[model samples]
Target: MSKLEAGIVDGASAGYGAVACTEATKNPVAVANALLEQGPHVMLVGRFADEANKNFGFEVVTNDHFTTPYRKAYWDQTAAALGQRDSGSEMGTVGAIVLDEHGNLAAGASTGGPTGKVDGRIGDTAVLGAGLSADSKLAVLCSGAGDQIFKHLVAANVAKYHVTGSSIRDAARKALQSISATGASCAMAVIDAEGNAAIESTAKLFSVSWAPASGPSTTGLLPTSFPILPTHTIHQCLRNRITVDRALWGGALCSCHGRRRCLSILPLHGLSKEWHPVTSKEKEFHEEYPGYISSNDGPMMAAEKLDGISSRIRAVSGLTAPFNNRFNGPDEDSKLFARIIRGELGQWRIWEDDHHVAFLTPFANTPGFTVLVPRKHLPSDIFAIKGEEFSALMESAHSVGNLLRQALGTSRCGMIFEGFEIDHAHVKLIPIHRHSEATGTTVTVAPFNHHYQGSVTSLNGPLLKGTASLTLDAAELRKKIPVKTITSPRSWADPPRHLSAVLQEPWYKSLFTIQDALFHDSIAFFQKQLGYKYRAAVIQAVAGTTAHLKSLLELHRSSGGKFPRVTVDDALKLVVMNSNDWRYVVESDTSKGRTLTRDGELKLIQHFGGAVWVTEMDHLSVPFYQAFIDDTQAKARCGDLLLGNGEVLGAGERHVEVKDMLAALEQHQVPAQGYPWYTEIREHKPLLTTGWGMGIERFVAWVFQHNDIRNMTIIPRMKGISFAP
Candidate 1:
């Protein structure tokens, strides 16, 4: 590519002797080398120089070239300052796709590439046809787990769906379903020929903003924020050269064309087929070709078999007679609704009480399939539930059903209480998006009848979408409270020589600084400006990013002038026992927020720890962003880094108390204010301000692919070992 650039430059300088299309197309590489004279070899200095300028506010770094021969101090110095930003020297980095009005469609992805990706590895972002695609009929860009997105070519398929008559919203949703089905979170932006636009994500991290075509040009608007101009989109600014240069560049159009401006989750098609397992009778009759399973089995036999399977399968998670020895005995069966108070199972619990616990079941026949189980070990018979008990259960069921619809982007919910499954009295609440789905589970726990089908994704089910952390009623899965008596001994020791030498390379050592800057920059984008801000600023988001970064860097230098690295297995050991611990969950502290849900948590992890985009709500308007770490590598790496060695430096409790006390001190401010001074001052007046401290280190690790976040931190601080304080 660099050679091509140099050739273009040399040609411009040489003369205007243009080659015909046939000659250029047949021998492009030959033409660049020339017919005889020694060909000019071109070496590229890589894009880090320009990337540094764009991200770190550096100067003299953008679009600059220098004589390269390992001797040019000026160029060498510039290049030295920039290393592999994130995702190493690999196959695919990151990309931003946006339509430009420079009369051409230029796709630019502003978000950073997945941090610790493999060398020679590329994801959808690197593939134009996969992550981004455009034509005369439509254009689309997608974000999420790139591998899944690439396989489905979400961007291209979205365009196809749009041109084939699907509405803009429908097209985007349908395209995303392919990736979401794989339990991978993804977001997409789409625009059709009519200029109608839509954006959707299976997960909640999607942000769509646009300025009117004739309105403010997207000149300086932050990419993560709103797009000020139709053309100056964040993606356009960071457009991928390969994508642009490889395919012909052409003029681009606006998604929300014309002078209108709008940014919202577009209404989806009001239709979803009620998916269900094959009826027991049908399954038995057709189990094997025409003969089926035990061809002569009586109709009653099918029901009996299905019921037995449900009873066993539903109880498969934590039965007393467990295999791995995790469970002392079998827990309650699915149908036995009364045994729902199994908090130890670590399932996604929404609401629970002494009589009943409402939770999203892993046995989800449909997305967001929830069940209300009674605490008592009662029989599956509804008659077993006394009037008062029934009333109470029904009341909660009604409420949960309603919340599921409201919070999950569905209009109706189907309630079922079939005795065929586990003899337990459990009530199922399935969000009903279409008339057919009203039947709830048509088949009796068939395997194929699963939630998050690798089909088009939708929140039409209680398939809780956004609000990765926000639940219906500040509800969280009630975890088995940790043993208060347990004591952790913090200890520390120097790492192996190889690990200690990890950051010796200058470029490698800079990983910490670069990612820290990225995080701080994100903070600035959220804080209340001298002008507008959010409606509600979270009280705990008081940690200033600048201060935090400075302190963290100081610690990193002190530790080893770099972060440490650890094997995945070794990293997991730090928190394996506490994997179920709430602190590990990617979310704001549960005590602070009202709406808390773990649907996203379970969805992402249940399948090797990948996330299905939060399919439902817009959490920003409610609580702050609730991060859900679904990837295994990202999750385990975080545990190791967070522990430092055997434990974190500050006690979580004291830290919270200090923050709260600080907030209290605000009242003392001369006629002072509370923690979020903006709320008191009405900074972003009228807008509900929401705030939360994003785990910058975790994000950095994720993007930078830091093996041991310790690589970026100070010396290992263990619980038992004292540091050189």
Candidate 2:
């Protein structure tokens, strides 16, 4: 027998084989088996082995069948480059070990001698212990650098270590280490009588698969760590179809039912999915925000609401899992405001102070959109600030605006205050670029058409149809109005002028008598139509005043007169100067004051010539959170930025002191019991905070010079409108 068939054996028989010459025999293993069965010798080789194969009736064939195209190319290239062919060019040796039901073990290895080798050269594959070894206790098969393997007796060493009480893994490692020390590479698979097995290699094993008798089968490259050996007997099978528990290992059978079914046993890192190493850039990001994992495995911090478009900001901890925005309560543990105050949710934070934080909104309505939220869960009303809090809030607003302008290369920023949706006070900032490509060179200053002719007949037509004029003196009407006792001349409030001082002017007296007479008649008209009471008279007065001013400015512009020429700004100043008389009657037992209904307000807005700022409304006319103009608690310390579409932004100071809050609560008729936490903040740790909110859609509409606010929202959420996914 040749060395290729030197040490191979079966459960009840022994065999070995090798290709002896260029045109040798087929079935090398069969020839080796014939030699073992027919002779007293343990092996045979060269011409003698071929003659024995023919004499024993084994089939022989031409050498071309064993010479693959790849081996032939390697032989040619090696001969051309090194002046001689190399034996290493021929690879893909075959080997196998089998255990039968009787507990007998056997192994075999076979390969043609390396291409271009010496005519009589014999390799390790035909040796007893170098390329193949088998006995009752263990079996081993090795491939690679046959001469070196023969010199080191690699397979024999593995069997030696295994028989000497070393584990299959330890024996494999020892054998591999010995081969590596000799400057050679080799790989081997060893199995012991107990069914334990291991494969150790100095080169990649390429592929490995296993199926235990009781679990799913798996296939993949071996992990860098320990191999996960099968717990039950496994036999090599054809066609790569590993069987587990008597069923085919495919589809559902391959899933990890109760145990890990992966080919390699790797660390899982407490995640449901496979662990992946973090990239270098992600590591840097983690270094910048320490304690925050870049992966999706940590405390639940933020989530998208069911609406899909809107998202909820959440606390890093203290919240229940699977957060839902629709189910969240105002004072719930998940409130983002609470965590911001505690400094736990610091990721993505841009700017912050003792009372508030400014961050880039994850659900930005536009580029550079940001949210400035108070750290405390104060009531959703912007008017609830008082004292220095008012000034600080304004300062914060200014700072945010400047930041957006400088960072976003925008000329201005838009602000708004409407907290009807979220019961948290958050101010929205939208960067306003003057030269937006969407609107081009056309800038929309106001959203209404200014086409009314500046004629008394045109302006008076609507006013005359609504009511009959009153004959009361303007001076008498002015005395009946309540004069605020505590007042300060601020930029947002009228310059500390008494109501009487305003009524003393000739122009104010004329406008006051006409506006008052028209307001009463309009009230009568609205009461008769709706059969209910509302402040529709105030709506009519504001609307009429707006029309009248626009007409006067239009007429002046058309006249082309130099002396006493009237401009739109001059007309607006006239309206602001006469604001002292912008009042409506409040009947006894009704609310302290009233403003126009939403629909009525919208109607009045259509008449405005341009943007206008109104301030110092009646204290009871607004929410109790608005700070009082003074200790008298008569007027709210708030201002509204009204556009042709209605109030787009609102700024206000909040009540910081307990007494002031209690007094304002009583004046506005809101019960203190309903706001226990809000009351406690004022009682224990009052903060002087002020801020403003702006509607993102309205701001974008204003910036882009669009008349329709709906166009501004990419996914518009209008009242009474439903959208399908």
In candidate 2, position 292 carries an lDDT of 12
- Candidate 1 off by > 4 Å: 1-106, 214-389, 392-725
Q: State every prediction's TM-score relative to the real structure.
A: 0.24, 0.32
Candidate 1: tens digits of C-alpha lDDT, residues 1-725:
01111111121122111111111122222232231123332211124222322332323311113124552453345446655333322122223333444323334332223433443344565344676665555566676677777777787777666666667777676565545434455767665545566766554234446665678744221111111211111111112211111000011112223322221121113324542322233312222111001111122323344444334333432323221212122563432232235444444556544456666655444445667776665544565577887888788788777777765556766665543345456676766545333232111211323332222211122322233232221222112222121111111234443343434633234443455445454543332121112211110122111223333443553445454433332323443324442232225643321211233233223322221111212222121112212321111102212321122211111112233233323422322243355333334333322233344544544333333554444344446654343
Clashes of each: 77, 23
How much lDDT does candidate 1 score? Answer: 0.38
lDDT of each: 0.38, 0.50
TM-score of 2: 0.32
| Residue 196 error, candidate 1, Å | 0.9
The regions of model 2 sitting more than 4 angstroms off are: 1-7, 10-22, 113-118, 206-725
Q: Candidate 1 — number of clashing residue pairs?
A: 77
Q: What is the C-alpha RMSD of each candidate to the true structure, in Å?
A: 29.4, 43.1
